[model samples]
Target: MCDTKHCTKNNNNSRNNNKNNVKFIIREATKQDCPSLKQLIIGLAKYESRSLETLPNIEQLEEYGFADQLAKRLFRTVVAQLDGGDGDNNELIGYALYYRNYTPSQGKGMYMEDLYVDSEYRGCGVGRALVAQVAKQCVDAECTSMEWLCYGWNTSSLDFYKNLGAVDIQESLECHKFGISGDDKLAQLANKTVDQQSIKYKIRTGVRDDCPAVREMILKFTVDVKMNLNKVVTLDQLRDDGFGDDKDSRQYRLLVVQLDDSSELIGFAIYYNDYSLNDGKGLWLDTLYVKPQYRRSGVGRLLMSRVASEAIADRCHTVCWGCYAWNRRAIDFYEQFGAINYSLVYDLRLFAIDGPALKQLADCALQ
Candidate 1:
């Protein structure tokens, strides 16, 4: 957080709904601003050519984001609004929504998920002001980095970020370098017939008996990522986390792909429902992994296909996942599927607070 004294400011050349110039005040979002913030979100989707069905309603946004007594808050938003306006039309011209994302490589950092400015508000300094404030907040929070995905084809924004010194997320390529597929395209991929002469594989839901296999695969995945399991999460705990019958615990769905003639599972994808105030009924792809020997033989693709097919069948608005910046092969594979690689110019980041910091936070009291 920039010193509150330094953060809030008014933009001189701002635009409002009336097309009349208005002073834009950039500051922390308040509870009453949820409606305008939601509108900005929808406007962003439309401008970016995405269906509005993907976003949540204003009431949902308010409850999740602004409910005052929640023990732990999940997200925060900052808004750029007309400082003064008559009636209830105090238009919020822009906003930025963000939260923490954790990755082993970097400690706690900021992930700006949405930053949108009304059409008329572009060119004004509202967007830059919002981001600059967030960047300062990232530093104040002791985060190693702040990251967000940029539209790959938005050259103007790409150049802007390049001037800001952002680097590509996947290849470390700079500035000019960069979804889950849409439901229809995913359906097209899933429904296509495979060649009879090619390697054959089948995907099926994981069962209790398959827990050991899944556990072993997870271990392999950990090693592949060049990280240690640390035994903090044991095989039994992993099994219970997934196969447990408790309704209150998070429920995970696992899809496995294996050869036709054998029972050996070559690939697997683990996903579950991820509902947010902004993204309603989405699918979170936890892990998609294929054995090294079986990769590129269509096992990974088959697993992803099943995941996407199930997502569409279950009415999920989107599927979200992440990849290591160094994994160029996996990056390319996902690219072929038209998965939006956010911020082709700079590798977006995942930030986390864990281990000792997690314990400290749990024990900390309000000052």
Candidate 2:
């Protein structure tokens, strides 16, 4: 939900009214709203040229909308309804579905999963209102930032988002895949040399009490690039989730590196296998951090080697993560490990609400 005070700004403006003097109300969605939400998602899929991949089927919607534990824990959907805007009937005109996202490097963030307005209501400020509502929610949640992707061809939507003060950090978003049949040979070759000699320090599976040290390492790595290290999981949170009786608790695997004799933690790595996609399996290397003094001493390489080997063992087909574009040191390290750049991300920011003016700025390269 949005913070009422922050959302009040410009929300009551007459610009959002329809031709019939109809107003709109933004409120949390109910289970009864699932059908309409599905329709809106389908519409959005068409708009994005991904109609074939439309998500949240009716059954899945019911699960996530009202029943799924994680969904209930993580997200909330708000719908925009017309007060007599829909031919004197107060019907749904649009919706915004968003959830929290956390990365040790990026910190607490919000992802706007879906935001769409009925085509008939396009020019009446519906989109802007939805954005403002999410922004308010983001502020209320105290998130370090908010992010979402807009297609390169969607100039109007891109312009709209930029007008609302979005920063496109796309160039820093790197992705890599591993564990595919052919890739396993490369991974095996990389691992054959992994021995006590290849390891500059001892590596062990993380214990429950290691969260604090792990978090500190992550904070240091992210701080090197001016990124936030938010409170995603504190030591208490880790104990609760990892030690708790939850089926999904086994999803994560964390490893820590330490000096062989001193037993001092100097680095850490976190990875997990995700089964959400149908393409075999997917593995994510969420974080890999080593103390600056220990860096370039094979600590990072040892961590990467272990992660890739684990991905192969798990039968995963992809192992991926992002690196900041300006962090040339990190990029060079990743290249040495055989990771290829799959996409480019562009970060753009808007200082004002003028759509045309923002578009012009986006057209110009950074000086």
Which candidate achieves the best lDDT against the true structure?
Answer: 1
Each candidate's TM vs. the true structure?
A: 0.56, 0.63
Model 2, span 22-130: residue lDDT tens: 3666667887888888787777777765634525566666654556565233246778787554366767889887665445553445656567898888866666667
Task: Write model 1 residue lDDT over 166-242, tens digit each, in one string.
Answer: 55443442321125645677676566454424767788988767877877887888787666566324556556656
Which ten contiguous residues of candidate 1 have the minimum total lDDT?
358-367
Among the numbered candidates, top TM-score falls to: 2
Candidate 2: list runs displaced more than 4 Å: 1-22, 68-74, 84-90, 104-106, 170-193, 196-208, 226-255, 259-262, 270-286, 292-320, 328-367
Candidate 2 backbone collisions, by pair = 168-347, 168-348, 170-345, 171-345, 171-346, 178-318
Per-structure clash totals for the candidates:
17, 6
